[model samples]
Target: MAGRNMNVYFQEETYSKIKNLVAKREISRFINEAVEEKLKQRQQQQKEELRKKLIVGYQSRIKNKKLQKILLTYGEMSWEDLSAKLEEQEKNDDNCKK
Candidate 1:
């Protein structure tokens, strides 16, 4: 791969520590690899966040669809029919309590 020359500033103490930790020739390579790894981690975290958002959106749509189905079922009923259904459900609940 082609490389470009760029100047980077580091704190004196940090730079001294890094110099102590790595050979002079491999410092740039080490920094490059560390940056690449960090970038990959950031990209993976972004993908996971998007996946979670998609899952939540999908679940919301499913919930809305279920709500729509329930509304559609009851929307066709007359007030008297709804009242009768409510009364029947109440009776069933009363029975279940016994």
Candidate 2:
């Protein structure tokens, strides 16, 4: 944990809930869980942005004709080689797939 600081903000009804959590000796645990979840969501968003940037960067660098040529060329390879190629392709393809 580095460069972390706290500032308090209150919503209309959540303070009592937080206070109850504190009285139960679970406030820190709850806060940590909330932080962990927020971090996870932020990380996921950053990952998605990076992926989008890479896709745009790659597409800007290569033409569709070139990509199609590469795929078609792989399609002509030996079955074992093609299977390996397809597996690799499938892994990368899965990243963009929801």
Candidate that would win on lDDT:
1
Which residue pairs in candidate 2 have backbone atoms (N, alpha carbon, C) closer than 3 angstroms, thus clashing?
Answer: none
Q: Pick the candidate with the highest TM-score.
A: 1
lDDT of 1 by residue, 27-72 (tens): 9999999989999999999999999999999999987997899899
Per-candidate RMSD, Å: 6.0, 17.2
Cα error, residue 29 of model 1, in Å, equals 0.5
As a TM-score, model 2 comes out at 0.50
- What lDDT score belongs to each candidate, Candidate 1 first? 0.96, 0.82
Q: What is the TM-score of each candidate against the true structure?
A: 0.66, 0.50
Give model 1's TM-score versus the native structure.
0.66
Specify the poorest-scoring 10-residue window by lDDT in model 1: 61-70
* Candidate 1 wrong stretches, greater than 4 Å: 67-98
**Per-residue accuracy of model 2 over 1-98 as CA lDDT, tens digit each:** 44454776878578787886575676656777798999999999999999999999888767677878887897789999988877998998998795
Structural RMSD, model 1: 6.0
